[model samples]
Target: MRLLFSADGSSGDLIPMVLMAREFKQAGYDVCVCGSTEFEGMAVDFDVPYEAYPHSYSDIYLDNQKTGYIHNIRENIRHRERLFKGEFELLSKIAPDYDVLFNFLGEILVPSFAEAFNMANVKLFTFPVIPSERYGPPMGLPFVTENKWVNRLEWAAAVFSAKYLFSYNKTIDRMRGELGLAPSRNLLAENAQCDHMMIGLYEELVPPCPSWSSIDYSYIGPCIPSQPAELSDSLEQFLSQGSAPVYIGFGSMRHQNSDMLTRTLVEAARSAGVRTVLAQAGSTIGAEVEGSDDVYVLREYPIPHHKLFPRCLAAVHHGSWITTHLAARAGVPQLVLPQASDQYMWGEIIYKKELGPKWVDMNNLSQRKLRTALERLVAREAFTRHASEFAERVAGIDGAKNAVESFERVKSKLRR
Candidate 1:
């Protein structure tokens, strides 16, 4: 069957989908990934066919950063309103070419696209989004709580409040109407249209599966592709220069005050008496600007996490899904600086798992606070032991293959 792996988000998000696309092709399905022009080269690198979305992800990200950065709910909805109009027009023409639309964390309007185009939908969640009493929804405020009951209450409130807060139901209905279809009967039902969902998160990180949604859920571990190569020679030399440095970088998350962030990381590492290696993803943390021997600012872009993390004392990052998994798989403790979305959830996981200290908010981050967090990460032996144990378990999971097997079942049901 023809499959369209629709992907969005940063390197943390897209890389796993690309790995799955490769797997689907290997399984002998006619598969192609569709998303931003910004990520076309990534698909090319993996030898997978790619399709461009109606609007670029950079434009959306820039707009979010400009218009109050995830706090401005009105602007967020307005931007989605503008783009989904054009997205509907594009998907209408191309969707029929595919038997199934396997969404790799596409925007919220994915269900609308599935409904309007009559596409077989399969949502591949890198992190949990569906409402559940088991865990809190990974978004703004009060995501996790003291117990499952509190989590359940939080979910009910958050989901209900979010629907009215965003007010995108009209946009959904409007998009459907424009396509000469009836308005959505129930938004939740629309979401439930998917034949299957494969959650690409480590099973150890979360509790066992509960059938919260009508469709079956597959708790596949994070799908990590094989590393491209070993670390470059200069990086090798740097790792050998005394002690293991804290690998710090916020993967692809934008840092508005990169200078301030940079200063904080270096100063904190120095205060904690540990060396630091700044990966510097879009943040000019350690880029030729007075970095000492204790602070090594990597000049290389896209350094393999697999190669570098094992050598680092701790992985400090924005708690992106992929970054969290990589850090865990490498047996390194984490210090998550959560900025938005499911990042906070991952941070909570790291803290709860004893893999790291409690996450420090970027807005409130200071040299003193970061130093304390880093010191805790280094001084505590449990964090290292827990991380190593998690890695040992993670090494056995093949989420990409599991996801393909689930899809095969979906295909069989479609045939039936």
Candidate 2:
């Protein structure tokens, strides 16, 4: 059977989808990945057939970097027009050949397309919370600040943004029009005409939620595969020289004041008397820091955190879900420096679990805060013990294998 997988955004988003595609290919099933043109090289590297989706939401968001919310809303409004046209073109191109279309957290488009074309589609979520939960109160929408009145106003604006600016609502209406069905309140319900809906977070991360109808949502755990990048001889030697250094890496997102952050991290490591491997990912911070023999900085590599975490005493990270899971699985205590989004929530969980110290908001981060957190994490042995136990539990779950099996099961049922 041929499977088409659609995903977008950074390497984090693309990697999980690639993991699933690679497994399907190894299992002797035909697999094609549909995603941003930017990631076509990744698909080629895995020897999977590559198809570029016509447009991407991240492209729009990245292009408009103005500070204010209204500017963002205006940019999204423009993005909606471009996205709808692009989706129509892409769906028309890929619909004829594929048996099933799998989307990794990009449920908004592919599910609607599945309904329109009478093709099977599956939604894969990499993070703990799904998008449906994210947009509302249960997920705690980010723009909803402290005040109730402001939160309500923000919600109202968000609803308007969804209807008029976001592409999801527009795409749903277009799909409905094509299907000759009246517009529906529930997009997931409307799109349940597809074969299966698979959510890729583990049960440990996200418990089961109420299903809408015949739609299937399963928490298959974290679909983590070993993606190892070659480390330089110098780097390897450095790691060997230090007592297992704490790993610090924030994928993609750049800080405005990376120099300050880097200096702070170095001071913290020095203060805590611990060595560190700082991943200078997309940030301005260079590998070389002044007066820091205990710190090593490098670019982001595909090295499995599982492998690194065992050697490391602890981790300092930007709180991306995949990183969070990997750190937890490796049983490495975490110091989450959340920049935005659900990162704060994940940080809260880490602290609550006593696996690490409280989150340091990136905006308000300082050397003193960083040093204190690291000092506490290293001083307390309980944190390390809990992390080790949690890692063992996560190691037992074969999420990628399970996802492939689940797909086959759903495909068989669809045939009948």
Worst 10 residues of 2 by lDDT: 133-142
59-171, model 2: which lDDT tens digit per residue? 65444433233443365345545655665677667765777778755345556666556667777766432323322221222232234455345445555556665666766
Tell me the tens digit of each residue's lDDT in model 1 across 258-364.
67778888878888899888887655556555546787777676668888898899899988888898899899999998876667788888999999999987646
Q: Supply the TM-score for candidate 2.
A: 0.82
Question: Which residue pairs clash within candidate 1?
Answer: none
| Model 1 score (lDDT) | 0.73
How many clashes (backbone N, Cα, C below 3 Å) per candidate?
Answer: 0, 2
True lDDT of residue 317, candidate 2: 87
What TM-score would each prediction reach against the true structure? 0.91, 0.82
Top candidate when judged by lDDT against the true structure: 1
Worst lDDT run of 10 residues, candidate 1, spans 65-74
